[model samples]
Target chain A: MRASAESNGGGADDDAAQVMGDGRHARHVTLKDVAELAGVSVSTVSLVMNEKKNARIAVKTQERVNRAIRELHYRPNALAQNLVTGTSKFIGLLTDSIATTPFAGQIIHGAQDRAWKQGYVLLIVNTEGNEDIERQAIRMFLEYKVHGILYSTWYHHEITLPQSLKDMNTVLVNCYSDTENLISVVPDEFNGGRTAAKMLLEQGHRRVAFINTTVESPARTGRLAGYRRALAEQGIAEDPSLIVDAEPTQEGGRAVAEVIRASGATGVCCHNDRVAMGLYDALRNRGIMVPSDISVVGFDDQEVIAAHMLPPLSTVALPHYELGASGVDAVLAPPVHLDDHRVLIACPAVHRESISALD
Target chain B: MRASAESNGGGADDDAAQVMGDGRHARHVTLKDVAELAGVSVSTVSLVMNEKKNARIAVKTQERVNRAIRELHYRPNALAQNLVTGTSKFIGLLTDSIATTPFAGQIIHGAQDRAWKQGYVLLIVNTEGNEDIERQAIRMFLEYKVHGILYSTWYHHEITLPQSLKDMNTVLVNCYSDTENLISVVPDEFNGGRTAAKMLLEQGHRRVAFINTTVESPARTGRLAGYRRALAEQGIAEDPSLIVDAEPTQEGGRAVAEVIRASGATGVCCHNDRVAMGLYDALRNRGIMVPSDISVVGFDDQEVIAAHMLPPLSTVALPHYELGASGVDAVLAPPVHLDDHRVLIACPAVHRESISALD
Candidate 1:
């Protein structure tokens, strides 16, 4: 790649080797020498430095290039680009919670990976589950003059955003806003629910139960709607008695099983994996065998519960990392119109041993 | 409490009230007035604002005080103290991941709560699980002139902190440095292991098994030590035959369970709740009844796994929130001597129905 381009420096391969005139110390190595030392083209060096995908370079060649760069202490001039753009090369990430859930981490990881590849860094602030803190965190982001903002909600809740940010470039993650115009990247909970229900239906189960929490929660409501939609598509009438409202707790799951049993449901679609875990307890307490007596499906596909449940829970998997990454992406390059505000990430159903064909 | 304090708005209270007059805003309604309106004292108001314990103030009085403050539109000039000290009223929170896991969010919540009470706001940077991103994050924090830095690792890894921060006040959470004299607040994995092991032993189980991942992992090593320590204290020999290495995955748990069956161990302690979940699947696959046939305990108390496991998993809880809160505290306070730099928080065990006495 370097051989194709006209030289900005003198035409030698060692063009980047000159020391500074100030004589304070040796001159810093640049991308040119790294390419030269690794016997690769300059574009190859850029690709390696930028971590760009679709490179036809061999793995061994890439490793050698990286080793040469590391050994020479070559630094990419990302700061120069920041100077030209008058941007801090930073994106502000505002979350209701930062350290407690695995979903947030996955999202952050996705965003961060994308941001790094795109030459941007993330500035994160936790709002401590308070609206006031959330407002203040945004103000702080503004003061730092971040290029963009990604606001991530812990759960689906109505957020009263600060008016100061009304004109700012922003995106919401795993949340929706009443404004309708704002960009939002959230897990496709409705689709996830529909998928779970479809899977159970395909197994020849008609008497399906929906174990969920309060209807007041947007997530629960959305999933319920999706479950109903899926059932309707299959020419099955909604069974009100099969719906159970359980607290989003283990005890709640265990208690809700009584309702499931009373409704004579053969299949159960849990609000989340946590609820499904509790269902396991309630099922075992009554000497019911999963898949045989009752097939269970959960949502969120939490790493801990999905792996550990007695039969291994089959659940709807939320792409946490993708959600986070997309949230940041939306902020960086939002769709132009309010009608295109929603970024729906696919939530695939993970097939574990929790569900089997109905006999 | 307010009535007495309003009558005694002497030195400190008066100073605080006057501080609000720096701008055109009127001497903001002092905490004294709120106390007076609530029939409490200024000190009582201070206690509430600081979230201090040992307060005997009635809930009604607290609500009254809060109402008065809201009605008066009182914005506390608490952050002024930070400006005087040339310290940014903002603390820098550096995390490797912000959106993937729940632990970081809980820790951030705890720290944010404590910091807000102390009149500090957090400026968050998400490194997105990249070492280069982390370096850049630290540089940004330094450029922004943050008062202190709280560096949190997403997973257990030896961290190479930014060299520029050698003189700055820094604290590490959930990760440690190879360098001496740096303060770190990490989960008490050893204590957690001991807690889980002791609980299982107390349930009268003698034939206990251990399923862990890589021995190189500090968390696994610490937990293994605690398990052995607990066994030694109880005069029980540590059985090599009962120890199995399982991948930190559900599939690994299934493979380990076959070994567990061969060893004839009646009780099991897992490296983490995730591994324990795998064990659950393995046990169910073999048609073994938990507690009746074998009792299992896990570590990390991952919410989903702990609540959802068939019997409700009994696991050692990591003090993630406390670790985050304490990390902020350490950075804010004077540095402790490197030789004496050790802060260990207690990890308590949560008892569920998973374990039963082996009589």
Candidate 2:
């Protein structure tokens, strides 16, 4: 295949020489080099490097090997060690476009911190939704003997597990399989939706509007159900007119502004922060004010938008960080049974200046 | 160290058993197993797996080995293969908080795509700015014998190289070292600033106010110089009153709203998209319409905010994706002389509704 313009490098043969060539990498300081310097056998140096307890090597000899290693700056080959130990202190994270999402950083941050504490390191591969790359990545992970694998997605949805993942110890994050085949961790979308409504309801807005997304997914279905449940708990009838469908974007929010204002709802719960931002623009254009004119609450309190909005939108968090951390926890702990493995982390509400109490 | 709340798993002892234990991982189907199934010796299986040229193995025996591998679902151990070949197809990406930045997704995406095309896999570790973790990650990458290392930051600036990175085939991305010790790739800050100014100047705006960041950094100095150069090219004098410093945030832009209006400039250039968004809000509240009253441009065309803004922002793109892809290219290519290895990728101007002719 022709290389992309950005690669801008020479052909494979040019790469072949430089792949292990003299220019980029200096000759690696190896175990034998250290062994020769320390006047010890290769195995003696290995035993010392591994800190093999009860090895019959003399203390003076061990000190000499350690000194030689420091002098030569030799790094023990982890691959060779993995071959002997049959295990690795690495967890492979294969994600479908998470690295491309704005808030994916939180997920990676949580997982990396948790993995680091447990004396393991996460090796992440963002597959960018390519099935071929995903397969190749999983195979590579297996070849490296990763302690476990975390198969994740950018958002919450149902996914079809790749056939290659069947035998590996894999946990699904932010996405699950219908076959009940893998342990999964995802956000509690239902509660998150309920949280948005409850925030508005607690401010004494009886006639609340839910600007639901038109797209069909777990978030759309689950959040709507949770909204209805919150209304039922408040002893209010579900008003079909107040529940309007939008595209779940800034434009979608702007498009539904007239419908929301005409419905006479004092407060509105948006599908997401982007939708809320659009509504803010539409409302500003129409000379309507937030809180005093119409209270608004958004879901997925995206930090860049939610916290930086004109009124600092009150919204529910997606628990993306928890989903990642839990994915790591699940993989490292004793395996949960396939039938009882779906774990849901709760989304919490964040109060800002967007909502106000009614008289 | 005590484990954090997120890692609600048992102690390391419990992890030890499960690390290579019965519950999570199935015993790997080894080369010996494949050889036994094929009724051939282990060396024959190895030779077939590697596709060694001029091997004396019979065609029938090779077919048997291949069939056994397919039947047993055996994945050739890449680590073991690396041990024999003394080369690896892995590149290590060590980042300081890039995963947490909003537009950092683009950088990782570009790098991953380029690396994949070259038959190399990227093993990314977001260090999150912890010095200890950064050192450990570098050591781990060294131990794994990664082909090269890409040390990246979320944004452009100068960085102190970690002591552990001194020996690796390392390339700095979106950052440069003060000592000129390594090859680096960064966004052309001066050109990016020039592009932002030229976009406004081309639209028949002579008096353009530049809202620069207050933070002392390359961006602050370079962009300002570029802005001056654009004005000089147009035979316009640099007006001291029109140049102002802000905190590079929405609030900062809002804080300078009155000053911008008072300066009588026909057009404005913002420090970034967030600042422009803030200025938009402030201008709206004061009954000033964008483009109609005063044209505006922003830097860092942050897609989520810039495209979704009321009037999609006209701004300069940061070339983050190029920085990452080029970092990979730099490491993979023959190393350039240290004194002449700083590569600057240009930031292009993106036109949108926010900019209009001054007339």
Candidate 3:
């Protein structure tokens, strides 16, 4: 609150007086003022503003109201319009790490793009992983009567639903509810893992290793499952030793290089791009060349890391933008009766230069 | 429009009917409904809802109106309240790349943090560097009558003012206006550059190279100037050859291996952490050890790149979050007279292992 202390001019009591106390302008412009200017009823002005011509006010009268609005710069109160129409052109984006993660901008862009196309604006609230903040944000969203709450997390994870969310039309993004029945949009981590493994396998990498996160993550688990499934389909016996765990970072990728070399794996599928970056370093340090000597693939095709890779990393795109856009689409769309509104967008293969086909 | 097609249920007309047509509910809750429930005039209900107790309205009548509101679950129209109050409790964040850049999330977080503590919500608009989008966003912000507009850029750059923003209270974050008089909150890039160079100079390195972006950038130019100034201060003649240009990425950093080798500079100040990541690779490739052989410093200490470096990277922090938070604070606070309302925040030095003192 101290942060905004200077912004505090007058509290609630001074609001009305301030509206009428503009000495230079005499008073703030309002719908009533516009109505008086146009010589029309308050309801007639509201009808013209809402574009609700169903009651059919004369065109001449409507034009006069419009002229008065422009002359006075009298913008209608969007909040009041929502009250009469039962429509709040605001979608609440309640996120834990949307404002902290590298991929955050993409998700928000997608959500904003979708919301605006529908004449709605996004109300963003970053809770920074505080349960109390999240609870309070939900309450605030309810008070504003947001059309829906887009509950998004920075990364893919499970979450405890805020009790306030239960009473609202809430959509989960990059996360899921504890119990089913809630709508969710999340990336297909398993598919991404399979895609990474398959890319290496198609490049004649029979001995492929997967270096993944040491931390227990759904992405890690799901990716591993897909990796195993992809290998199984190729009639390769499951070699659990080929799968190793690291911190899911550049250091983690580097740490697992010895294991990869010891296992005699000719190719590697990293958990994500950061891990792949480390692998590139570790391999280069050991004088192990990429593609020719060992091929590499990664998940989450982060443009900054993957594009800047020496040969450009071939990885699975996380589809975070699609997740946010589709999540908004799903929630804002007409209600569908699904067993559970769980939609998984694909993490498609982004084949760049890292993999080479063996003769 | 196609994006929100499903969410669009008969536009404005369907709103009132949708509430009343729920079948389970025979009539929608409205002011008339509340007034009837309380046995009071509609104006009395309005005065009560607005809390305009003016001493004329009896205490008993006010209590009846309050009970009716709770019983009917009547939510006051926020837009109307805003119209009366001249307070929207909403701030517009007009950004070109908040949803695209890796550092953007930090900026949004800081802005959101500052806004919320003051009971305001951020309405995000990612213009994606489109002029039309930017113009439209500005108009929308004006229509909503946002408390203030936080016009931000993905990177540091100069932008032409949008015509729609001509009459609005707007603050620039991470950028500035062409002329004075506009309030701006931006990171001191020159200071950041100086910090990077100073860190290397303090480590007893006389010969220092600055690897900067090939493409023109405020950061690249500012950092180069600081690098030159630092060398000149030590009476080390500014060697034009010591200033190398690259793509301002890892690949670009890696490509400068031969120049670094030939220049004989024992210390380097990279434009950013990504460039530093590349240098680490190029140096390691040639068996040139960091710090022991050549100390390195960088700007924009990106956590993923700087923290994950083999020895970690010492760099100057960008302070993007502060730019956003303070930008909001500046705009929301009472106006102060200045040649230009420019507030520069310091980009402090961050020490890591990439730099070392010479024995």
Candidate with top TM-score is: 3
Per-residue alpha-carbon lDDT of candidate 3 for residues A169-262, written as tens digits (9 for 90 to 100): 6789999876745778888888888999999888777889988887776797898999999999999998888988898889889888888888
Candidate scoring better on TM-score of 2 and 3: 3
What is the C-alpha local distance difference test score of candidate 1?
A: 0.70
Clashing residue pairs in candidate 2 are none
DockQ, candidate 2, vs. native dimer? 0.42
Ranking by DockQ: 3, 2, 1
* DockQ of all predictions against the true structure, Cα-based: 0.11, 0.42, 0.43
Candidate 3 per-residue lDDT, tens place, B156-229, comes to 77777786664466678887777534677877777777788889888788888888888776776776777777
Worst 10 residues of 3 chain A by lDDT: A19-28
- In order, the first chain's TM-score in every candidate is 0.75, 0.87, 0.86
Docking class of 1: incorrect
What's the true lDDT of residue A214 in model 3?
78
Local accuracy of candidate 2 as per-residue lDDT tens digits, B41-112: 977898998888789789999999999898777777877766654446778989898877878767887888
Off by over 4 Å in 3: A1-28, A32-68, A334-340, B1-42, B55-61, B334-340
TM-score of each: 0.66, 0.88, 0.90
- The lDDT-based order of candidates, best leading, equals 2, 3, 1
Q: Please provide, for model 1 over B1-359, each residue's C-alpha lDDT reduced to its tens digit, 9 standing for 90 to 100.
A: 22333454454334323322222112224555666666778667766765555787778777887887776554443222221122345677888763346655667667776776665666666665666767777765554446577878765657777775554567777788877457778777777778888988998988888887864666788888988999999999988998888787666777788899889888999887777777776676677888788998988777556656677888888777787788877766634454436577788888898898966
